[model samples]
Target: MKKKTRTRLLVITACLLLFGLFLRGNPDEIIPFGLVIGGAALIIYGVKNRRQGGQPTVLPIMTKEKEAHYLESGMTEKEIEFFRETMNQTKKQILQLQENINQNAKLKAIDLRHDTLRASKALFKELVKDPQKLHFANHFLYTHLPNMVDLTDKFIEINGHEIKTKETYEKIEESSQIIDQMAALIAKDYQQFVADDLEDLDVELSIAKQSLKRDNSL
Candidate 1:
């Protein structure tokens, strides 16, 4: 048996034994049958739990680099690893895009792109908890992120050379506008990314709490 399972069985056995002793000490005092039944039921439930290999519901999610941040966040080890990997990939793309934005000559475009990237980073954090829902964000991850980075990089290279013609400036401005719009659209998708995860988490937690209550009553 697992150590946790053994511990639970020991606790249940102890409780049941104490109850039996209490009844024995007061055999003629008309003890409540309900107490005896509850104790027996708890013992049976513990045995069943052991047989089924039930585990506890408390899961903590935190990366080692976070330095005790989210100490109380409940996530399993797999969930933590998934969240960390997703965040790393996202930060890489954001850094590349930010570099391009910083190199842009237009101050307004640079500021807008910077703000959009920051918002996207925040959204990434909010949406990472639900790995299942991550598939819904594939377009942003696989297409928009790379596309924005590529467009901005090319625009930076082209704009750094000269400002001789109005048409060249227009092209640079257009590229900035396109990248800015894509980032905004990507940010909008963040709401969709987290929606399903939040709903599922609510349902899971409700079921877990109800199951705990039922077990306790038994």
Candidate 2:
């Protein structure tokens, strides 16, 4: 068990034990017996679970350092936790999609699909670095990315049939075209998310060039 889990269990056990003891002092109270029994059972179960290498029934524990880092980025603890979970889920989906694309010979042959997947992965990496910008990626995270993965999965499945009819071929072509469109949309999503940064860079570059030209005129 994790230290956090052990600590939580210990605290709960202590509270129960204290309440049980307090009730025990009141000889007329029958609840004290049950409280004590329950507390004891809880401790025993926790210990046994640990001994058996049970998984911790908690979210990933944030270290003080990581919490401080995210705090500096203007994210509350709740937001940080949410971002972490969301990013982890998104990463898994992206990886699975990449694996699917790689395994399918037809998908590998499509240059547009490769480019699209690369763009999506790049955007995901940027989000991982700065989760504060997660708000800007709501559509990408909740809709585009998921839909892209699902469509690609279905496309691959359809393409995998040993026997193919003309209709099947047509459907596969249509799916491929739709996936290409989704890839373009995903690329646009990435550009829009970073549009501010790109604009800022452009402004800075223009300012530098004007300053240099003025200095040369002197």
Candidate 3:
């Protein structure tokens, strides 16, 4: 069960138990039924969150631009739908991190990487057309992006306590470095795709020019 869901259930159960006792009823009998219902609700919530990849807060928003780009990239309707959901979830996480960065000056390092994430996201939208490139891009789109978001959120949570110990400082430093590295790797992946496309375009243009010259000679 997710920690929040479990905590909520525990609080509800405790409150129900207190209420039963206050009424001078059989606490054991009253609490058992409440516990069973709460347990079921917790199980349901946990399953739903698990299916959502533990991001219960993220709502999938499919933008028109995303649809147009995906269609232009030759993705089938089904693949477009799948990738849309993936992109929405990633966008939610990235937006969350961005909002946090804006609010927290201590998270300046995370803020610095925001542009890299955005650039990589744009490249990813373009590169998804090629299955071979998409295979590698998945690491940035699915894994590393989410990891950076989670790490930033956790770091912010840790900082909220205002406990400035050496251990906490070290953790903050480590997280900053890791987030920076992930940003660099994502940027590098996107650049590789762009470089490949540019090279191919150059070759095609050269071939076309040579063919035109040969025709003129003939």
Candidate 4:
């Protein structure tokens, strides 16, 4: 069973137990007893199933339509699978970073410094459109992005402390600077990744201008 399903069962059990207690003084005591027993049994079953490792995690699988789309884009099955896994991991890291930013005012300020979260999400969207270009984003996907997540996690951890000495303050300041730098670098990564596309647009514009100039001269 999924954790969500298990939690739902536990919640229902709690409600049953509460209702059973409420009905304790009723003329027909059997209903209350039955409810209490059923609730207890559910709790026991949930605990046992959890202890036995409820279920294996299910990985995302590409459907035939998605596979065909990627195939048309010249991606092999292996490359498509790799793209799925890589994007999945990247998305999770981005979500964690967003959550961290929401939790900490400092991180939120850093994100606003250069719109880091939005830039990261934009990068992910671009990759989804042309996953074959994923090779160009190895550093962003594997190193810089992961580093951003880790730094934010540590920053949140240290910032959560009730007491802070001078050294603690210095460490927090240093971490904030580093995170800001990482944010700038992530923005740069997006720019660099799209540089070629920008160049192509420029070339097309130049060609169109030349054609217009010739038409005017004629």
Give the alpha-carbon lDDT of every model: 0.67, 0.80, 0.70, 0.87
- Which residue pairs of candidate 3 clash? none
TM-score of each: 0.46, 0.68, 0.58, 0.70
Over 87-142, each residue of candidate 3 has an lDDT whose tens digit, in order, gives 56666766776676666665665446556646655765665455335665677777
Off by over 4 Å in 1: 1-87, 105-114, 195-218
Q: State which candidate, 1 or 4, has the greater lDDT.
A: 4
Provide the clashing-pair count of each candidate structure: 1, 0, 0, 0
- For 165-215, candidate 4 gives per-residue lDDT tens digits of 999999999999999999999998999999999999999999999999999
Which pairs clash in the backbone of model 2?
A: none
Q: In terms of TM-score, how similar is model 4 to the real structure?
A: 0.70
Q: Candidate 3: misplaced stretches above 4 Å?
A: 1-74, 105-115, 127-133, 201-218
lDDT tens digits, residue span 178-210, model 1:
866776777666656667778999999999999
Highest TM-score among the candidates is held by which one? 4
- Order by TM-score, highest first: 4, 2, 3, 1
> In angstroms, how far off is 185's CA in candidate 4?
1.2
Q: Per-residue CA lDDT of candidate 2, range 9-62, in tens?
A: 876776676677676686455466656666776787689777778854355667
The worst-scoring run of ten residues by lDDT in candidate 1 lies at 63-72
Error of 4 at 150 (Å): 0.3
Model 4: CA > 4 A from native: 1-57, 216-218
